[model samples]
Target chain A: DAGVTQSPTHLIKTRGQHVTLRCSPISGHKSVSWYQQVLGQGPQFIFQYYEKEERGRGNFPDRFSARQFPNYSSELNVNALLLGDSALYLCASSSLFRDRVTGNEQFFGPGTRLTVL
Target chain B: ELKVEQNPLFLSMQEGKNYTIYCNYSTTSDRLYWYRQDPGKSLESLFVLLSNGAVKQEGRLMASLDTKARLSTLHITAAVHDLSATYFCAVDTPLVFGKGTRLSVIA
Candidate 1:
């Protein structure tokens, strides 16, 4: 089976511009999560959607928003991008998502590399 | 908010040597995860430890978790150069990550 897939392997945007990155979850998976990773750092969670509902969010700014589709695909949008926003955006998928007691193995996509010039 | 910390942010060892990386989290959580990320690459799931004293092993790497101490460890046995990469441990407060430990296996 195909794993989680992300689109637009690379993107270049100017400051104050907007960008959207897309992800398709694995078959039978219903939860999608977004993460931003800067160089030499671990990924920082942005948003998580389960069954097309917002389930969790991280400390990112309001400029970052995301939504999930019925098919478990997701889009992460960043508005008024800044040079500080330049990083790799990742998408993860899992069949289940309960933080402490329950959760299926999560898988990650290749990620979208975005550069704000 | 929960925080995750990793010790020895960098590791360098000779092939056939063994080393362990440690992860400590601030909150109580039973779910801990280990992931490997190569340069310019996405993360690859390595281990999922769901309970106290949970241990899992694959290939030359082993991961163990202790919920009581809120600690997890990833041990690399007989390291190989191919195993060079950054390793991160995440706690399941909806998934919070550590700064990651970069490992380099030298000849």
Candidate 2:
């Protein structure tokens, strides 16, 4: 089976511009999450969607937003980008929102490398 | 606030050596996860520990979790160059992540 896939493996944009990164979850998966990984750091969660509904959100600014389509694919949009936003944006998907007792494993895509100039 | 921390932000060892990477989290959490990422690469899931005293292993890597102590460890046995990468540990609540440990194995 194919793993979760992300589109536009690389992107470059200028400050104040808007960028859209896309992700397709693994077959049979329904939940999608987005994360940002800056240089020399771990990935920080940004948003999560399950059944096309927002389930969780991280401490990102309003300029960052995301939505999941009915087909379980997701799009992460960032507006008015800054140089600090240049990093690898990762997308992960699982069967559902995990519970403490029954945890779910998040499968990540290769990620989109976005460079804000 | 939930925070995950990993010890020895960087590790350098020769092939055939053994080492352990520690992960400590603040507060109580239900699950702990270990992931590996290469330079400019995405994360690859390694292990998930769901409960106290949970232990899991794959090939030359082993991971153990202690909910009471709020700690987890990833031990590499007979490390090889293929194991070189950054390792991160995450907690379940909001999936808090550590800064990551960069491991370099030299032959």
Chain A TM-score of model 2 comes to: 0.96
Native contact fraction, candidates in order: 0.64, 0.82
List chain A TM-scores, every candidate, in order.
0.95, 0.96
Worst 10 residues of 2 chain B by lDDT: B88-97
Instruction: List where candidate 2 sits over 4 angstroms from the true fold.
Output: A99-102
**Relative to the unseen true structure, what is the C-alpha lDDT of residue B72 in candidate 2, on a scale of 0 to 100?**
98
lDDT of 1 by residue, B1-107 (tens): 79999999999999999989999999888788999999999999999899889899999999999898999999999999999999999988467899999999999
Per-residue lDDT of candidate 2, residues A32-94 (tens digit): 999999999999999999999999999999999999999999999999999999999999998
Off-target runs (Cα >4 Å) in candidate 1 are A99-102
Give each prediction's root-mean-square deviation over alpha carbons.
1.2, 1.1
Expressed as tens digits, the lDDT of each residue in A27-84 for candidate 1 is 9988999999999899999999999999999999999999999888999999999999
DockQ of 2: 0.82
Best by lDDT: 2
What global local distance difference test value does model 1 have?
0.92
- Candidate 1 - CAPRI tier? medium
